[model samples]
Target chain A: MNQTAMAENKAITISFPEELSEVQEMVRACIQCGTCSGSCPNEFAMDFTPRRLWRMVLMGQKDDIFKSKTFSLCSSCYYCTLRCPRGLPLTEAMAALKQIAAKDGLSKYKQSSLFYKSFLESVRRHGKVREMEFMTMYFTAMKSPFLPFRFAALGMRLMGKGKVHIQIPSKGEGKLKAIFRKVEEMEGR
Target chain B: MNYLYYPGCSLEGSALEYNLSTIAFMEAMGIELTEIEDWTCCGASAAESVSHLLSLALPARNLALAETMELDADLMIPCSACYLNLRNVAEKIKKEPDILNEINTVLKEDNLELKGDIQVRHLLDVVATDLGADSLAPKIRKSLDGLSIAPYYGCQCLRPYTVFDDPEKPTTMEPLINVTGARVHAWDMGGKCCGASHMNTKMDVGMELVAAILRAARGADAVVTVCPMCQMNLEAYQKKISATYGEDLSMTILYLPQLIGLAIGLSDKDLRLDLNLSITESFRNKLNNDCVK
Candidate 1:
């Protein structure tokens, strides 16, 4: 709304940090509308709402954006993206933020990041996840034995119903491993 | 029609009932489903968070395998997350040939290439749309009369791409539910997020959201979902969510196939309804068909 400030600021094009260059397009297209924040289900839990986060991205506030859970809290429900008037890939932006956070060794949601790591590892090794194995690996990987006990009742119920499985994961182990190897080699991870 | 089926990881483990019910329902309907050989995880809720390329690649491998087999029919994925992953990657490969090429370079050594030729569809879509309502009507042996059903369209299947129905407000399940002779509860919370796998990552946040949907479906006899994660969170975690909210928000949750399976006179064993954590007395006694026996 400040024409004077806007006119003064217009001459200098702001460049985001190299890591955030991808989101510059998204931030530029943004109308500073709070629709994304308004539409987000987890907006109430977000420290800095998505609308404010976009503005921060424009201002090259990498530290602030990374510190905040705005992107990390995104579960990829696609509500904000679906509701965005600018037709931005808001969900993908959130995914990119997570990628950046991981790259920077900054995890806002520790539990979530750990879970993702454990789940991905399970798939990487077996080409399929056996629930019991996945949970054990997750708990062990996180070094928090108490967490599994928290869901013990529900876990037991799943087991009781014959839902919990122990199996020899078959079919194309060689090919599956090859895919993981390729991705790992490509990502240099 | 014959189709390549991708069950995903959840169905084999935590969401086994979804797998069983889907298979039973499909078999009863004469829909042949051959499980895609040596299928791996589609990286469901986690793969994308860690790495986008890994997320796309994991699902792409499965797609590539299906394509390699030359299974020409549309791929039928039972779980919503897998359906979304497969469909997203398949479309991505079509629209942005670069992504497919990127994946193929890795896949090349193994003699695999993600051609993205297959039409990835959800079990819900196959039954509701392809199988159709009119044809399904005659198949229902025991009608689900007097049961108010809430069709929970949890996040994945209907978002970013409105593959089968409206994203914000979906009614794809209505025709299927109707043909089974049940009353569809036209509630606003149908398309709400189930917080996905956040139930593990962010328990309090995820549980609260699940509680709200369960509360919204208060009047309905049962909430039927097409996604394993949705059904698991709503059913398995309902009690926990209830305790958190300090409300007795107990409700029965079933997969869409389970409801149709029951209506088609398929017994409890066939549908694996016993495996569901939240089988309400009303549902078990009235609609489960086991009561009739």
Candidate 2:
């Protein structure tokens, strides 16, 4: 019910990271050896492999690369970086592209962003992630009812067994109030 | 060396077993993880995605708290998302003076600032680098002879910034797995995404991704991970993902600490087997009768 969550709930344009020089350097490191394609575990599943992504970036095809399904299929695993004979940071570039895609609202990463926001909100409130019950409830309310029941049941059992503390420790302690307020303001809540 | 430990949010929640086992296991390994006094959240996955400043500020607040605690050692974060957020802010502030100023100004209210001296390390990094494979190799109370473990890094720990080991095909975990007397299964899905938080929002998309990772881990007895989110996503969604893909990749998902505890002769109960989805009667029987003796 805090303002930050409200702002996140709003339909607003989000900005992506500026074109990173570091990412450019990483793109240039790709020697087009196709080793990245060979080492990519999900290459067969993805439309564009790591080799093609680097090639597209180098060819000034940022828009096409960003819009492709290849970026979404990236698991952020370091296989391409590990296999790149040129040692280009493929995963980082993927992350940058993902961030840019999210900012541009080109990809359907809003759910991913919401998940991250809700997690931080829970942490900020509880000083830990003891809100699985609430998280399950919130996510379910958001319409994803077939979520993981195992974790929710596990959380409840832990709470009942004194293994987990169900209450937020910061209750009445204004320590997080200022930080939470700043977060709210930054989120434009 | 002594270090301030940040278990992040998941250690205390869904992955509480990881926290419990980590504390016990680290004590056994002669390492001390002093929890920061009155520590706040590292903002995990969401804050960073929505607002860059929000992400930086969230972890910066925790960094400030660590500085205030005046801990002499680096901050050891066990959760991948928390580790990335803290490390990301630390790296960002150094390059972008304005980010440092903005985050520091926000921390000013609490009389805090992120002292870049506090080095952040994942628990895997601690076990691998700080503990050293040779040192750990000597302390294996029980050797896992027949157990096959797939070391899944789950993105945030090593990617986005090559701060740790090889980002692509990282095997920083291999040495730890090796030291634990277990076989590290060679798999391309070691660092693949386990759908992360999306498993909650987009079940179809998330389950497909989770299924792919599980397929890659087909032959392994268990998948050992360093992230709670990864563990949760893989373990909690296994049945659903399996049913969707019509494949029975009955893989037991565990945090590194839990696996370490098992290797060090801790009983399954001691490692909290009740929380795992794949720790069924068959798997438990397999552990007791087959390997890890």
Candidate 3:
């Protein structure tokens, strides 16, 4: 551990990343309502609940907050955000946390990260998601030899029905490249 | 009435049935929907986690393109994710001009700009409000009599920013379903989450959430939903979720437009009911049968 960082951790006021300063200020409204945690559809599997995570934010546990899988597993359902009694924009905060997790390389959900990367790969290639090819890439990338076959029967069924497409098609939106490139340069990712 | 339809990525690919039924429903009502030319993915749940700017810019780019075209009608999105992404653009631009300017500065390189004045609407909003019940009543060619169904309005359609209908306890789709004579089964879990991207991220948990919805909708003929992701999750994961939950959860998940299209006399080829995963035999028979006078 870096001596300065460890020392700063012991101090009463610790420094946070520039973006988190805003979050840190807004989360002060949290009353530990537990409504968000209760309402989250996937909270049953979380290592730390959203309520606890909000508490951590209040406590300035920046390292723990970044490393936690709480936000990475959000799924962007916006249930908690909509149902929050405090009207905290909880989902937006989770999205911001996801960005922080991505930028800092702090995501604990490898599968989640893998899936997002695969989705982005498809979008970059054709500007649309070819589900069959995306799943193939995802299982192959994750080194799961059995998963694709497991999904094959269902995939074929969907393909037969024209639900799961077998062909790769592009929207031919060349301007998308410019938009993506600009965002990449802006985000420095 | 005319509208610029944004089908998004999933609609063109995995959720093609949603696209089919929405078009059929729109067509039957004599509403013209012109697809936004060269529209790309909204970046959905993926971009928001990867880069905030990417999330905003991806959808904003589509809006920018729509602006450049000088489209005649308000943009209408059938997919909940696309609707949320497109509808939020104007609000985002107005709420954060610095970020808007920053994104605009980036977009200036492409000879495009993200304008905040563009009106974005969801397909449900157009059907329920613009078309109205009276306008739709006479159009019903086939009656959905004795066909029991539950309306599943999953996340993103009415939340984060509810453009149409009440955020909680949405009954907007009730009258639309009622007009078809299909019984609208009132359930408490209507506006709940469908474990969204978790299907790809966390499979087991996703199945559990789907199982809960299935259990909640046990006796109904099908769970009629507006979101493609929700439909996909509830249907595609049936076997796995049934196995996981130790129950035979053979629940039929339907697109809202599919239900509407069928009730309004659209054919199987038109709405593409064959694309549905967990098919209900009764639903099919009724769909294929001639409209009851």
Candidate 4:
């Protein structure tokens, strides 16, 4: 076999990480029917259609898979999962892919991952999301000075409607601290 | 009837109208709600992306707290995302004892355990199944007679679980809308995705999806939603989405309970209708002229 053929063979046999074993198992059942992609509301925005991503998953194109924003673009509507002819848990697989990206600390997903982290951090602190505080944290962590301005009009509208509550940061009641702490320790993060 | 209520974060903040209207509507229906003490966030759609276990554990913590209440009643969640998260935990633990044990090991940090005993239900499920349209009809003091409402179920409430309503062709809300004397707007976007958190993460995509739903709901006076994320996406972005799409995609977006509150003769203050973002002047006039007692 020539070098190019050998490389193609190697690509075809690449292994997915253990974190995605469940997704791997489920995606293997996909018939490439495109039902998931067809059902996806965000398919147009995805770098790769969900069907194409599933095909890549089968082919173990891990690098190409992570390079695309397909999974992160999943809004978790579960329409794909619902419409999957094989009942493949497509949404959960998408979520598992997100989990892998998050666990790997992939820079490609930094913005979105940071958003989720900021959200959970707020929840961990207050036992609930303080909207203004959460957004503030996310914007600050994002280090994007223009980000808050983008939401300024909407934020003002929400505040005008009494939807956004401004709270001075203080020690939270620590309602979920123990749970968060234990999970962090267990997850070995 | 009673329930252990889990008003997730958005209900307290952005979706306060959902909370207020829910309380008033449920109370008027002769149902009592006992709020779960120290009920934390149910991780929404973000948690599972970060940690699958944290997602389950966060909701499981709330479930454990509900179990401690000893209510023997199903835990009712108003937010669809919260409902899905908590319901996912409940369903997962029921199917896998090992998963339950793992979550319990984490919950032990909070001095809680996952027994998987309490049933988790969305408010829509409770309203449609437990308090059927027939039981609720007599409570109507003012008829929303001519107003056409698009019953937008969004995504979470009906999908992946299929608990009380058909995931694809949901008709439960139509009967409830009929009981209020409003016409159900004929549209197929009821079960569609409203871009959800992508409104924050990926604005273009979210805007496009929101524009589609809003455009599809043009003939209706208002779009009735059951999810906070959906309500916010549909209500808050109308002006921008309209501008981007070069169409007048303006419509009143409100909670299902708020609509019911109006039918039941609850005050606007009771329903927090003023807090809703995109309630048009025409919609207000219609409600005031026809639905007000």
- The ten-residue window of minimal lDDT in model 3 chain B covers B284-293
lDDT of 1 by residue, A94-140 (tens): 88777666654554545667777767766767778767766777787
DockQ of each: 0.58, 0.30, 0.62, 0.76
TM-score values for chain B across all models: 0.96, 0.95, 0.95, 0.98
User: Higher-lDDT candidate among 1 and 3?
Assistant: 1
Considering TM-score, which of the candidate structures 2 and 3 is the better prediction for this target? 3
Residue-level lDDT of model 2, residues A1-189, one tens digit each, is 897666545553434323544456668867788987786545665668778877887775655565456655555455576666677767667766655555565544545544554555555555554465346535643465655453566556556655556553334334456776775675454
- Order candidates by TM-score, high to low: 4, 1, 3, 2
Give the higher-lDDT candidate: 2 or 4.
4
TM-score of each: 0.92, 0.77, 0.91, 0.95
Report clash pairs, candidate 3.
Answer: none
Model 4 docking category: medium
Superposed on all Cα atoms, the candidates' RMSDs to the truth, in angstroms, are 6.1, 6.3, 4.1, 4.1
For residues B1-293, could you state the per-residue lDDT of candidate 4 as single tens digits?
99999999999888999999999999998899999997888998889998888989999988998989998798999999999999998898778889998999998887888788899899999999999899988888899998999999988999899999889989889999999999999999999999988889889999989988888998899999999999999998889888888889999998999998888888889999889998999999988884534
* Candidate 2 residue-wise lDDT, B197-230, digit = tens: 5566546666777888888887787888888888
lDDT of each: 0.81, 0.70, 0.78, 0.88
Model 3 TM: 0.91
lDDT (Cα, tens digit) per residue for candidate 3, span B10-94: 8877788899899888888888988878788888888887777878877887888888767678889988988898777667888
